[model samples]
Target: MTWAAVSARRLARHRLDAPATVGGDPVTRRIADVVAGTCGAHAQVMSAAEVSVAMRVAGAVRGDVRNALWRDRTLVRAHGPRGTVHLMASRELPAWVGALGGLDADRGVAVGEPYLDPDQVAALAEACPGVLAYRDLTATELTQALADTVGGWAAEPVVDAFRDHLPRWRWAQPTLGHRGALCFGPNRGREVTFTSPARLLPGFVPMDGPPALRRLALRYLHGYGPATPAEFARWLGAPRDRCEEVFRELGDSVERVTVAGAGPAFQIAGDPTHHELPRGVRLLPYFDVFGVGCHPRSLLFAGGAARRALARGQAGNYPLLLVDGQVAGVWHQALRGRRLRVTVEPLVRLSEAESDELAFQVQRLAGIQGAEEAEVETGRVTVGPHA
Candidate 1:
């Protein structure tokens, strides 16, 4: 198949070809639907995640995402795929934990130093659920509690990410989540807190290893299939050989296909979805899941888009303007109280219809952010990546 067909299918899977209606679904369910459909959202910037969920639905706003996350608890903040902050639908999180435990099993992923032994890491992971069970603890409080629960080694400031040294347990927090122990609790004041999924969900249990990994592979193929194991590894932040092994285990469950630009790839054995032309104009925010997950970067960010939309070959750093399922430009938005000003710098001139769609996308953005007024200017976006 051609790259165009692949892009179209991916867009349709993401519900980006057209806005999907929630119908009579409540706000929480709507948010979870979008989150699960996108395979989880890049939520380093909480507002970006809210926009990511809101933009895919017919009528959702940022406030709805918060209500789902905190009020209804339909969605939970987890350190998910790629060890980044993601807003995952609560129900699907166990499959992620079960499938994604491959990374958690690797003690070297966090650090391969003697200061943090695999046994110590295991102890910390075991201690998390009990300490955090039915309670919320800020980073500082959690680390101290963990140290008290496990050993003083859990609190030693050995791992360094920020200017100050952080405890190994803190550095390996994401892995703990995959172990079915850690998840983000609501913020206490300005500080972030961690909670146990066991307490959050009624009966949270990590699925069995091999089958869960297969489920994850199937999910990946469904959303971003006709992709290679290496691409899957890149997306999962796991070893390529391990991913290739998963594909091998699946055997005939997936069908191998030759994508024109992407070379040999695989999709679920019997994909019946129709691939139509992905025609639309979408304004995607920073760390949008689609921009980050699409494979064969050379095709997605073709020609000038590579230089304009990406930062050092990394996706999700710049907001993207998609035209006909391709990166057509870069965009930025500034919210000033009730007003939202959007600036788009397109690599190609948008047709009248696409221009209208872009305006509608701007309106969607304004609605999601609860801005009273919206403005757009199609010109050079004078900002660098992530600005």
Candidate 2:
């Protein structure tokens, strides 16, 4: 297939280098629309999730995100791509559940056996909905209920499991919600609880696996396109063979493109070509979709920026500082009473204009966090506890 050559700057511009101001039919009015834009916003770090949404939507407060998740039910918190906690649009639960939950079977006994014997996992899957049906219950409460329903084995916690992996339940909890059985309820202090999506959402309809995965892949390419199957697989945390199957399924709907230095990539057919390099500095929160979604890290975090911005190869360890759409450095914020101190550690010496832009970005970050005032300092600073 012939590939259309494109520049890295153009690719970055197309991906919303200035993410705070994404252009399209403005859906910032609805939280679901914002979440759907990036497919899903990372919520593994709650503060990061709040900042991610707040930055995208005009006049949006952190409480708005909280209300959307807990009160309005417009967004659902669940294990999404890469088996990480993400805030997905409630209406898209069916597609997300189908796409992500289907991976459980593909993972096979090798992954599942270590957590719980296949039989135990099966039993818990069968009993999970009932245990969490009408009431929002905590992890402890759910474990006890599962134990009561399935047996003591259901309460056993798995070793080396990521976030709240005890009881060895399936990754996509929204899958249960898609069955009209369970949804995340408001937290009781620091403890999260679950109830029924049917009761909470009222009009959610579950989509089947094939269509759901297809829709997800298309949306992903649309938002972070000119991307590769390996990038897709890495983002979804699914087997590469399965991801390639989806790519083949896309076929004529997506056209191949050549990104400068990054080789071949794919984008939705008929999407307009962009060549403008967005001008500005942006302070992206930890796990911000734009930073975490793209692949070929060497291109995005080129030169010494990668070494300074990332701890090892992990992306979310620190908030990112972007200049002209490339990772330039890392930043951290310290709150002292009403004043927010944002310290930036740039890997490269920035121009005076860029430093001014950084100051503006710091003020924006302070506003997102609802700080009364912000102080921008250029120096090396330690990563905060949030990491």
Best by TM-score: 1
Per-model C-alpha RMSD: 1.7, 3.6
The residue pairs found clashing in candidate 1 are: none
Cα miss at 32, model 2 (Å)? 2.1
Per-residue lDDT tens digits for candidate 2, residues 195-250, read 66555666656677777888899989877777898899999888899998999999
Per-candidate TM equals 0.95, 0.88
Q: Which ten residues in a row have the lowest lDDT in candidate 2?
A: 1-10
Per residue, candidate 1 scores C-alpha lDDT tens digits across 239-274 of 888899999999899999888967999999988645
- C-alpha displacement of 245 in model 2, angstroms? 1.1
Model 2 scores a TM of 0.88
Off by over 4 Å in 2: 1-29, 157-183, 384-387
Candidate 2 Cα RMSD (Å)? 3.6
Task: Compare the candidates by lDDT and give the number of the best one.
Answer: 1
